[model samples]
Target: MLQAFESAAFAAWPAQQSLDLLGWHLRLDRGYTKRANSANATAQSLPLTASDVQAIENHFRRSGLTPTFRLTSFAPIEDSDRLLDACGYRACDESLVMTRSLAGFVDGSEIAFAPDAAAWLDAFAHASGKRGADQAVHLEILRRITAPCAWAVHASDGPSPACGLGVLVGDQLGLFDVATHRDHQRRGLARMLCGGLLGWGARRGAQTAFLQVVAANSPAIRLYESLGFEIAYRYWYRVPTT
Candidate 1:
């Protein structure tokens, strides 16, 4: 179900804008519960006009939901930030679409899969430090990885201190929800978790791996770069005004 959401989020672009909008709702509603949300809208041409902005804002306002817009940095808009500002929108955070080639990568020792749905949810929430739709979504992901995929955790002195989830998607392995306990930082646990997932991906005939990261996360960016992942695109967020 998590994979379905991700795929739907990606596929909704240029196909089903309303469904795409709902996916954004699921993501933000899960995160903020109610205070904030975002939406991704696109056009075939560049340079959105004031009227275009108003139209989008009206659409959301009529739906009784606040509107926040996300546009790619590569979008052909001149002074997009200014346009958004004029519409009462502000830049939130920048994020990158990163990809890595997985050819010739080798799988390392296997990590044990959690025994049941409850255990998986517990580990995921423990690693993430919270609960809600994100946890529920990951739980669904585990339920779907019944094939050439693996999920696992690693411990320092006791039971695993950090956990990671990964899956083979086509010719690529995708890693998500890699987290370490607050007490486990600076111990290289994140690296170890990620490395294990990369190894798993390689063994499963994946030729590449991809993940999204907030651009402001320097440490993660550095780690991924060191691991041979390169920035493929920059995605930006904006909001529409009523």
Candidate 2:
């Protein structure tokens, strides 16, 4: 199940470039998000040796990116993690992969679905406060998605208060970029937007839903838990000290 989510996530949030090396997926996207730019383990059967690590690091360096690794429970990478630690890699940004069955999922209020990717990016920028170069990078990632997706936003008389993305791969739905404007938070906008996204996925035959969030985000974790989501697994990144 963990591996399944990993695959779905890769497709849902794709990188600009990817290469398979020694059971690790080396991804790069102008050093944006770690998930897109880090080396992620995909197979346990292939041994991850110190030389392989050097090769991976060299590849990232050649691409002008910091060598980073996303170690997850999806694959048996305990040895790899230990090797990275020994090599002065600092572990950080622990996150949870939450999931729930959408057998009886319910949605609230009529949330607007963006007519197109460009419109969705505009609303997301307003709600997320991410613009300029970041907006272009995000748009590229969104455009690269081949799976069915829904860009949901909740707006009132003024600018949008919340925006999110839902990507469906087979029977699974992966939620990403769920954000509410700082000024409009605590007004239940995120919950409503998430519910609407889930509904959009459920209606399209998605039987399961998954989302990733930083473990330290108590409020966000609580909100997901309230919606029947549970922590299915944990993942963290390893980056060089210098």
**lDDT values, one for every candidate:** 0.61, 0.89
Error (Å) of candidate 1 at residue 226 is 2.0
- lDDT of candidate 1 vs native? 0.61
Which stretches in model 2 have alpha-carbon errors above 4 Å? 43-47
Pull out the clashing pairs in model 2. none
The TM-scores of all predictions, comma-separated, are: 0.71, 0.95
Predicted model with the maximum lDDT? 2
With a 3 Å backbone cut-off (N, CA, C), the pairs that clash in candidate 1 are 69-238, 102-207
lDDT of 1 by residue, 1-242 (tens): 22332343342211212433222321232223121244553333345577766665665666555666766654454565678888788676678867788878764644666666567567767776877655664455455454454566874345567887666766666666677788877787778778888887787787778777889989889988988889877776765343
Candidate 2 lDDT, 54-122, residue by residue in tens: 999998999899999998876788888998998889999999999999987777658888888888898
